[model samples]
Target: MASDSLLLTADFPRTVRGYAPSAVDEFLRSLGSRLDALQNQLDQQAARCEKLTADLSAQAKELAGYRLKEAALAGALVATEQRRAEVEQEAAGLVERAREEAEGLLAHARAEAEQIVGEARVRADQLVAEARQARQAEEARILDLCAEFDAAVETMRRTLEAHLALLPEPGSTLAELSLGGLAVADAPDSLAQAA
Candidate 1:
């Protein structure tokens, strides 16, 4: 029982030492934040898919209901076969009316679909544009940072080379040196200028 209580000791954290744990904790926090963002985006996308699926299911149900009503009418009418022949005889006239109705429905559906798709396409384009702009900004920042780093590194190399020139080598001067042997000298300000 006492050993079980010892397991619950909160003072263990206060006893820990060094920057190692703190650095690890910072890295974990950063990783957690990124993962949380990804999770949220995934959740949003899942919700969108779920809603779209539900809407499509409802539309299918409505269309099925219409089909059932049409079938019921044809079944209840005993003279359906005779009427079907008459309807077929006037099919040419009805065909035009049906064509008009179908065209109207198609136009409406197309307009609605276009409205939804256009809005989505616009939103997607905006998001893509924003992402591209963000990428460009990040790339510009990285390029600037890289240029600064390169300049700093070149400066450090030049300083080191200058210091190295002040030290005496174990061997001879530049003109006295063979092809493979190194000779000590200060670095030129610019290789292009030296050339």
Candidate 2:
């Protein structure tokens, strides 16, 4: 045969006596629902935060790429500016060389012109002197020939009158006589034949 044991319990306080069993049950159920709603809100906020963080990181990476490209372009710009300066310097040297060459050529041309003018002046003066000498010689020859011709004419006049008295009434004229020691055949035979 088995025997059963009885259990004894202490009495509740006055505040605990006014507590309703159904009311306690309702409060616990409400609390559970509120906790579930809060958990749902917190989960949504965390998901939004993750998406925003991912977008911000993507934007930062894109900005870094843009900055790198800008830096490369800046380097290229500097290189171009340096090359331009070098080219300008080379061009300036070329211009100076060209100007020097032009000046040298101008000097050479001026010297050549002066030399040519001087030569022409000297040649012209020589030709003028030679012409003057030739004219003086020809004039002196004419004067000498005139004096000899006057003497010969005087001798012929005295002899011609004596010879003309013995001749017939028809007399020889000056045109028929040889004058200035020249005859009709005075030129050389070859020259006469060619003429």
Candidate 3:
């Protein structure tokens, strides 16, 4: 760990016999030169290591950010999948409810239609019966009128015959008596003809 200045400035103890000062100085200088070269190489390596460590630190930070992003993306995917499932389930439930409501409405409509048809049939039958009864009543009334007319004609004919019988003989006293513009003798024949 000695520096070049430290090696040059070093002191040695005097002895009866010892290594030469110049030789020691020459060896010290050579060792110092080698150490300087090694130190330069070591400094270069340390700087490279520092740069590599900085790059690694930055890469680690970037990697951590990427992991955070991945986790967030994964969580988002899971939430999205769950939302989709909920939506699908809700849609299915809505469809089922709609179908049930439709069926119920259809059944109600069918029942209403049937009731309408049945009521219509009953009303139609009542109308037809009423018409038939009215027609029968009209026919009976017409028949009664015809019978009354015939009975009135018969009564008139009988009254006329009785009056003709009360008249006198044709050429005797009946001729002397005149009834209205006709002679009494002709009254009986006129009455009979009228009857």
Candidate 4:
């Protein structure tokens, strides 16, 4: 049906001589072979176009999948950035607190050290005062003992002089008799000088 227009039609007149039969038959056969080659070329071109269309559709689908993956990765990157920011903020807060605590500890240590030094100074002063008092008291006791010794020596000298006045004169027998070389002549003078 599609090749109807290309077909050769015979219109021989009833009174005129018709075309040569062998030549017409040869021309028809050559035309039919050319038509057949043209139809084969058209069918090949259609098959190639269909394969190209199918390849284009597959490429479009692959492009859509890549776009979806890119969008998902973008969202994940944004979330990671947000998390990093939060962690940094928290670390900063902790560092600030640690610094404040360290400062407080340093201040407390300084105060304690000062207090200890003050107490040591007070104790040292008290010890020096006590030693000075003890030294003064000992010196006073020594002076009192020296005074008592002098008083006892003075009383003994007076008693010896009074007892010598009660003895006999030097020309008497008692003065001639030696009693372990005890001469009473210079007794008062020696006792006064020794006292």
Return the TM-score for each candidate structure.
0.33, 0.32, 0.35, 0.32
For residues 1-195, could you state the per-residue lDDT of candidate 4 as single tens digits?
256335555333443577677677668767866777787888888998899899889988988998998999899999999999999999999999999999999999999999999999999999999999999999999999999989999999999998786666677763353333555443466643553
What is the Cα-based lDDT of residue 162 in candidate 4?
88
Candidate 3 residue spans exceeding 4 A from truth: 9-16, 79-195
Per-model C-alpha RMSD: 44.2, 26.4, 28.0, 27.2
Clashing pairs in 3: none
lDDT head-to-head 2 vs 3, winner: 3
Top-lDDT candidate index:
3
**lDDT, residue 156, candidate 1:** 100
* 1 versus 4: better lDDT goes to: 4
Worst 10 residues of 3 by lDDT: 172-181
| Cα lDDT of model 1 by residue, 4-93, tens digit | 233333122433454465565666666666666777788999999999999999999999999999889878675788887788889988
Better of 3 and 4 by TM-score: 3
Instruction: Please state the error at residue 5 of candidate 3 in Å.
Output: 2.5
Whole-model Cα lDDT of every candidate shown, in order: 0.75, 0.76, 0.87, 0.79
Model 2 ranges with Cα > 4 A deviation: 1-106, 168-195
Write down the TM-score for model 2: 0.32
